[model samples]
Target: MVVPAMQLASKIPDMSVQLWSSALLRDLNKACGNAIDAHEAAQMHQNFSQQLLQDHIEACSLPEHNLITWTDGPPPVQFQAQNGPNTSLASLL
Candidate 1:
């Protein structure tokens, strides 16, 4: 789930607040199916889910310097010293 979220964000041309929300919502619905349902409660829950994912995405997104390489991609130079064999996109500072 974490990897999927990161991939979604990284693919964005520009991670604006609006784009982030809509993209996340679209992906969520596509992966898990639409949230719209016959019951009012279901709609409410769907909204809540979208909001929760939005919040989570924001919370997880830190400064670019704070970002780390999570996948098999090369690690940031800064990570070489502290991250050992692992590479992260952390700033040298």
Candidate 2:
């Protein structure tokens, strides 16, 4: 016997932040009961969801579309070693 093809369906939000934050904490529209632009709403979202932001960053993790900044710092200790036994895998080979 042959089985028929199986299909799956689900609903998704229009914005990524919706997936990032909760409907209760994130207004996105008129956050804090005032009309606001996207940046303003983003600030409001941050204000309302800083705690959730930490939780969300740790839990669900933010998508890499944009807005997140990464700072460059000194390399790891292993990289600082010039000719140590295990200086780095690249130099080893």
Candidate 3:
């Protein structure tokens, strides 16, 4: 079943933000086939809903427009060893 863009947006505001500058939601509705089940559709809606909220929170809490500037300094010297084994994947995973 296809969900309306406004209906989905009203249900998930974060989707509104992500779709605020794009037409991703409209495209999804168009491409989604009728074979999709209710459970799958609900799951997809929930996932997008959470993502929307997360994005909204991030946007609201960001310091981009504030007086402070967010920055990422260089990694610690110990973690930058060039001769050591490549454990980047291990650490990240």
Reference-based TM-score of each model: 0.29, 0.19, 0.35
Q: In every candidate, how many clashes are there?
A: 3, 0, 1
- The residue ranges of model 1 lying beyond 4 angstroms of the native Cα positions read 1-38, 64-93
Better of 2 and 3 by lDDT: 3
Q: For candidate 2, lDDT tens digit of each residue in 21-75?
A: 4333335434555343334435544644565467666654533322234234432
What's the C-alpha lDDT at position 88 in model 3?
37
Clashing pairs in 1: 75-87, 75-88, 76-88
- Model 3: runs farther than 4 Å from truth? 1-14, 17-36, 65-93
Model 3: number of clashes?
Answer: 1
Task: Go through the candidates in order and give each one's C-alpha lDDT.
Answer: 0.49, 0.38, 0.49
C-alpha lDDT (0 to 100) for residue 69 of candidate 3: 47
lDDT of 3 by residue, 1-93 (tens): 245544554464456553442244444544664334344455555666677788778876754333244244432222334777644323643
List the candidate numbers ranked by lDDT, top first: 3, 1, 2
